[model samples]
Target: MSGTPATALDFPGEVVTQAHVRYVALPGVAGPLALVTLDNGLDHTRPSTFGPAGLRSLLAAADEIEAHTPAVSAVAVTGKPFIFSVGADLAFRSSLRDPEAARAGIHAIGELGHAALRRIGEGHFGGRKVPTFALVNGAAMGGGLEVALHCDYRALSSDVTALALPEVFLGLLPGWGGTQLLPNLVGADRAVTIAIENPLNQNRMLRAAQAFALGLADVLLEPADFLEEALRWAARVIRGEIDPAAARAPVRRGAVWA
Candidate 1:
């Protein structure tokens, strides 16, 4: 199976499964898959992008997931131009814009992402087992990386894919789950080091092999073959060849930023 391979119904009718948050869900080669595609090559969903009514609809839409979601055996998210995710919407941070409104929207939408992620992880597809895989197709930092962390497995792109929690640069830590999940995947020592090192550009980001070596990824494969390789991994999980593990919270970094 491949990353969210589209399937056809027996009647050849178009099947549409509305995804949650800024994310979208579709059938993969093996099971149900969701994709967290970045908008305009940037991170976060636009406040102006989804109005209050629209947000309500999108958030409430997950209920249907309990009814429509299939067994999630594989998933992949690609950032535009080799960038996985740029974190939350820049518009949300523009102080001169509006923090109050942004905060409200964040709370509202954040809850949705939380539930959607949990559903993806726990929701059942059939009498069999379910597994989730995240393919860090490119640079995934901050919130984008947080999203990747939620998956049962993460496979970063071998081609210079940088992962980080740069929320400190913005005078914040990853509020989403980066602070916790990152260290859980790689370990407190390496996670803290990556954060403090503060690699400036994406080019400086670690590749999949290094990530795997760091325990961040299970394997490292070429970008050209990323999806195919991910499918291979997913198949193993589906076939009971792999067991899932829990991720831990990142230890608090002391004076590293100061």
Candidate 2:
């Protein structure tokens, strides 16, 4: 459990993929909020790159989170180093030993992530009665971006941290609710524009202000104040100082799908 898997190469300062997930409860004014940290310990790509095994581990990790979360009002730790998540591991996926197996595996993993997305975004977890937040300290692309969008609100870094959906370049669409989630967070126009545009041509990097303006990001803070800001924001909601219910905006129907 303390070492890397035999199938993986030995690398220094790398995030081991075995049990590469963890969860904890945050002490809030109302009750403890669940805080799950995704730790593929990846120096290159995300755990979503590992195919079926990775998907299984991710679902199992969510189960672990539920075990601790008998109560609601959860927030993800997008605030730490290697914070948030970096989408799928394209490098590793392209290197699959068997293309057929890899394709099937990617489909399965996408399904798993989509289900998890419904839980987080639709409020299935935390009783669907509590607000969830994703404190995105770093970049979140593809599935990672969808994860952040699954929450009611997002706290992003003021740095060059990006939030993108680049699934089109893969000869695939966003299967992990990214297409659905992005529109919900940002407006249909921006979301559809992003999806329609070629990711290979766009950087998709959003500064805190840009993220805030687009409504995809709720608040922006310096790296130093990021965690404090998120906690404070969540605490306010817990304390009845702010209206969390007024936060969500329905995704407008757009030309792409309809």
Candidate 3:
């Protein structure tokens, strides 16, 4: 896949959006899996935030992964150490002056994010429908959580400190499929708590344990070898060694109290 031109969009700050891809072969697994890591050059302090250029970069990476020869059996997306992503680049939005310009910019951002996420959700890479997973290693709020929700399955690290849809606190909503996908995954009441009620109540964030109880994560692993564990879990699911229904049954009861 061709890279997005540098002139395509002017992003704020020195954010260098990039996707690092690698293939991993799991024991007893039939085929190699594609693993994509999202990064923004900055350390965990900056957190990966999506802007127009950043979204385009992700799209390019997805395209490239889809075109891989021999066809991967599945795909997994993860983030840098101690961070999944904070969400959209609010700094970029803060730069707009005119209302019309701001509206158009916001619309464009939502469209780009949705399109790329939809492709991942449907596993529509290179004319195939492979299973997709999200390994949320740390904080994942707003658009970041939406990205995770788009995946077929998600795993979380016990070290994760924050998870929520805080757009409502900022006088906005999760316009990038969060409202729809969240309710479908975790039920309407909990979706309201995470996307609305909690945001209104000082933007409360869910700890990793809370998220697991809410059924947002299929598996929770210790930070030590978190990715390796998540990869193994994905392979087990793909190979029919683990039952997704059984895995979710225990969490479904926990969501009642979450």
Candidate 4:
């Protein structure tokens, strides 16, 4: 679905997820790395989610990263302590009564997510072709997992137990690029298992090891120092010490994927 650029929407009692940007200097990596932390200002019990306001917040963070003076060499997006994000705010969608309005809202939301995330995968940060990383330190479901898929590389924490595109189980689809990007990443067969089969079969989610085995994550890290290890790995990759594409599965396209 497509629509005009998304504008922030107001909803009662919305727990707005805020994107906080901090620049980190990783050893052996040139220039500063823009690290975005997604938080909703609540405990882990309440996972961060993307509503209109939250999506706007991420767009604003992207703006900040683009506007940095020295120009960020790399970008990384992560979540709070044990939660990245759980995707769009279902509470906001459930409150809508008009079908037309719901359709418009869904389109707007999907458009916003695409706008905010596509740049990372495309290396379009202020016209500089820099790599992006998704340091998945915790649970990443639905749109959250889609966010990781948009990055050049993903580092998943071993402690993560919930990672899936459960939208099918909820009678919805992964409208925000999951359907297309996932199949391209892990092959159509594995992507079907993630986007369709597992969700249909009791909404099964992937632990970090399972996701790694399925080629969803480029690296699996321990939770105790996931952030640090991820940074080191990124530095190594940046310095030509590690080759990310070497570890990835061969790309399948044309009739092979079909």
Candidate 5:
């Protein structure tokens, strides 16, 4: 029997996932910064995962940011309390049986994710290059890290326990820009370790400090004050007080490692 195409497969009914937008002003930044929170109305244990509905919600939030009154000087994305986001809903993919169907499903997911995230990555909002930041307050894995990578700057909480691309471990690659963006940001060698070697080695994860040291995160702050600190940091970045280049500079690995 011919297998059903992924696009033809039925997705579960929309969940309660939605993006909540908050406008806050910092001392030095012009106008207010639009903070978009990804929430699923569940506890941290459940973790926020992206499905088609979730992606639509995020696109809507991006629209709202573009249309904000008084305008926004910057945009920032974070997760509820802890747990930034665990990435795409694996259950959606698991439902596919045919290889072609699986490829179709993955393609749809990638297109939607890139469409939404690219808006943030290019800093395109209201026809302007609005600075974007990711406040990674907790576990950010797979697509979650990719989302953070899309942002111009990233801030991680001191308690983040899982930050990595574990797709290889599950017989997948970083489909959503991870393969392209990571190497450019962290260099070819480190990217190999993160995208290939690490996953094969029992899917090693990075702590907050390690992520920062690897140039994956711009700053690390205590979980207690992470959001506030991220906002302050965003203000500095918006005001041109911090150099984006220096903030994104890759760490120099010693020759011993090579």
Candidate 6:
């Protein structure tokens, strides 16, 4: 139809997801902790979704943080009030008419997402590789879950009721690193269960406890003080008070994975 809408901003009327960065002073953490908040400039009703424009916004935010003066010791990403993100904007997917156009759009979005999110894990900022944490404080689905997987560590909120990778159910694969990252984080079998099995079986989603048990997150905190607790937990991890490897021992051990 419309030549397969160009950028995620192709839809003139759609709201653009914005990545906002701010430095938070952690009590024990040495340098400033750069916190990136994803918001579509909307209320909780509209969960943030990454489109090309959104992905570009995120990259710019990372650029800003990396260029800061004093340099940051750690980096963390989180969502708005009640939502982290639901993944790629389905509106972009639904608008494509031509198969070739859809293919091109998907490729463009995938590349942008990879370039934007991978920096967190690569730890390329402030002349050294600082640690990264995904502070998942609310609902996260599809690409949202994948974004968390990009972080070196994930801190989830106990009140999160919906967490999933439902791409297969949506007639798409988890192209934006979910397929690879999920398997590596939780092992192959469990990754199959999450990335394929659950999506096939009625698009089942994971609750906070279920995801925590599955080893998707490093720690889970109460919702009442979710952000604060997540920050504190991140500080502990950065300060070496908490060992992520030890936290994931149960998952890495042969019992559950086997």
Q: Rate the local accuracy (lDDT) of all candidates.
A: 0.51, 0.59, 0.82, 0.87, 0.81, 0.84
lDDT of 3 by residue, 1-258 (tens): 443333334665637557778889888876678898889887888899888777877788788778888678888989998888788888878876789978877776777778767766667665678889999998899988998999999999998989999998999999879988887787777778889998899889999999999888888899999999999999998998876546564324355535
* TM-score of candidate 4 versus the correct structure, residues matched by position: 0.95
Clashing pairs in 2: 15-41, 123-128
Give the higher-TM-score candidate: 1 or 4. 4
**Regions of model 5 farther than 4 Å from truth:** 1-10, 13-16, 98-100, 250-258
In lDDT terms, how accurate is model 6? 0.84
Query: Which pairs of residues have clashing backbones in candidate 4?
Result: none
> For residues 149-195, what per-residue lDDT tens digits would candidate 1 score against the true structure?
77777666688456666767666666656666677566667876666
105-214: candidate 4 lDDT, tens digit per residue: 77778788787677555556656788889999999999999999988899999999999999999999997799989998999889999999999999999999999999
Q: Model 5, range 120-169, lDDT digits (tens) per residue? A: 66767766888889999988889888999998888889899899999999
Q: To one decimal, what is the Cα RMSD in angstroms of model 5 from the true structure?
A: 5.0
**Top candidate (lDDT):** 4
Q: Over 4 Å off in model 1, which ranges?
A: 1-66, 69-81, 95-113, 116-129, 199-204, 243-258
Q: Tell me the alpha-carbon RMSD of every candidate.
A: 9.8, 5.6, 3.8, 2.4, 5.0, 4.3
Candidate 2 residue-wise lDDT, 75-111, digit = tens: 4545236446656555545555688866754555555
Give residue 186's error in model 4 in angstroms: 0.3
lDDT for predicted candidate 1 compared with the true structure: 0.51
What candidate 3 gets wrong by more than 4 Å, as runs, is 1-8, 12-14, 245-258
- Ranking of all predicted structures according to lDDT, beginning with the best and ending with the worst: 4, 6, 3, 5, 2, 1
Greater-TM-score candidate between 2 and 3:
3
Query: In candidate 2, how many clashes are counted?
Result: 2
Candidate 5 minimal-lDDT segment of 10 residues:
1-10
